[model samples]
Target: MNHSSLDSTMMLTSFGSFRPLNYFFFSLTLLVYLLSIFSNVFLMLIIYFESSLHKPMYIFLFNLALNGLIGSSTVWPAIMENLLSDTQKMSFLACLVQIYWGYFYLSSAYTTLSVMAYDRYVSICKPLQYHSIMTPGKVKTLLTAANIVPLFSIAILVYLTSRLVLCKYTIQNLFCDLVTILNLSCVKSLLVNLCGACMLASLVVFPCTIVLLSYALILTVSLKASKGAQKKALSTCSPHLITFINFGVAILFFAVYNRYSSFLPAEVYILITIDVFMIPPLLNPIIYGIQTQEIRKCFVKTVRKNEIFFRICELTVFRKSTSEHNS
Candidate 1:
């Protein structure tokens, strides 16, 4: 398809093979989407209301959950719709919007993880200076940088992508990623594309490097400290480390699949592509919720509160019914 032909609509070939199981996929997608939203939202709400969780670490956790909600919201709803509807298509403008938000979310996630790693490092490696360094002002600044930098980077990418004349309309992946969109461009502006790729790489690499350094320093400090200190540091850093490793692996798989998509079968390609987006959002909340003691306590408390409320309501209804029957 030419630029004019793609001006209005672009087809998503990602879900084409799953047409026969559309309803099945629809139900599954909807369930996962709702679960992800609920988990992330629940975590954010806990952090928001719990005064004890107002520390720099939890503040970053809140932002991480918020990013998960935004990122998952960008694509899952569209996927759910496509599963229900016969057409797996979106408008060119809509596609661009999806691409922008999807990448924005990815960038935000990496930046947030980097910030969290730094927080852990300070807390574990420099316990005396932790509060002094991670003050409200500093935390606010970090949060601002984390959120704004991603938006700025993604906007440049969207601008570059929007200028490309389309050679095809069908995107092979489950969602509109920057790489897939570039592949569809008729005019392969190699220089511009190379520069764009470098910019994107910097976004990933800079933050990842910071995270690695922070963890390395933390590890070195832990080795010299007492056993209690080492255990404390491990407890605090384990969740962040798990999340980082999980996200890194997912992105690596996605990058490899995109580069070697021609070698993979349709089923394998689809699974790999979807894993990039699907796994992190769902897994992050679960990993954090279970692993972080404060979050786990808050979650249990909230659940208990709801259960008590329901029991009280049931008792009220039962008493009311008995009184009315006696009357």
Candidate 2:
């Protein structure tokens, strides 16, 4: 391809594989995107309004839901747009924007989960000091760090990526990805790869280590505690654990697919791509909403309140109609 031809746009070649089932894929993707938005937004709203849930753990959960929403919104719009359209092209600037947000979401997500792990560690292992250790000010600081660090790091990566001279314009995956973008570069830079490695180390690997160590300590404490305490600890950590494992799987697929996509069949490649975007945002809310007792109770309460309001409206309507008839 001519360099001038790709000066403004990048093609997503994988989209061509699904053209035969474009309508079906579009409808399915739209449904998942809507559900992800609704679930994440609903969770955030519940945490926001329920003053009783104004605590450290729930606040982190709120951030997680917020991240999920961000992640879904970052890619799902482009995905749905391309799904319906014949051309699967994105401008270079828009691709960079997607790459920035997509990676930011991943970074902030792991960072938030690591913070949540530390919160749990304090709550379970150092119960008495939990309040002091995770003060409201500290919570704000952590949330700020979780979001800001990722934003800065991803900005650097995207900046480096933007500076590279690109000889290719086709991205193999569904959305703009840093790894795919790096692969598009005509010349290889060791500095970019080094920075990427370090970023992954600090943002992804280091946070993952924190999560593991925190849980290991939690497990040690749980093992020595009473059975009731063990059950409580399990209940508290299970949702985060499940979400982490699910996310880990998605990232693994992402790495393998990007690195070894040539060995994989087209169907498998498409499935992996869709799975990366779809599973986590869809599952995170469900996992936390169902597994976290406080959120579950709040949801029930909110539903009951709505039901009561609807019943009151029905009764008022009936009374108004009866009075009008009698008159």
Q: Number of the top candidate by TM-score? A: 2
Error of 1 at 270 (Å): 2.1
lDDT of each: 0.84, 0.88
Per-residue lDDT tens digits of candidate 2, residues 1-327?
Answer: 333433678988777854668888788889989999999899999999999999999999999988988888898888888888877989888888998888888889999999999999999999989888999999999999999999999899888777878878888777888777778888897888998999999999999999999999999999999999999999999999999988888877877877787788767766765666677888999999999999999999999999999999999999999999999
Model 1 poorest 10 in a row by lDDT = 1-10
Q: Candidate 1 on 1-327: residue-level lDDT in tens? A: 235634668888767645667888878888888898888888888999989889999999899989988888998898888777766888888888998888888789899999999999999888899889999999999999999988887787777777778878887667777777778777777765775777667678889999999999999999999999998888899999999998888777877877788888778766764566677888898998888888889888989999999999999999999999999
User: What are the clashing pairs of model 2?
Assistant: none
Model 2 CA RMSD to the hidden true structure, in angstroms: 2.3
The runs of at least 3 residues in candidate 1 whose Cα sits more than 4 Å from the true structure, single-residue gaps closed, are 1-6, 17-20
Candidates in order, TM-scores: namely 0.94, 0.95
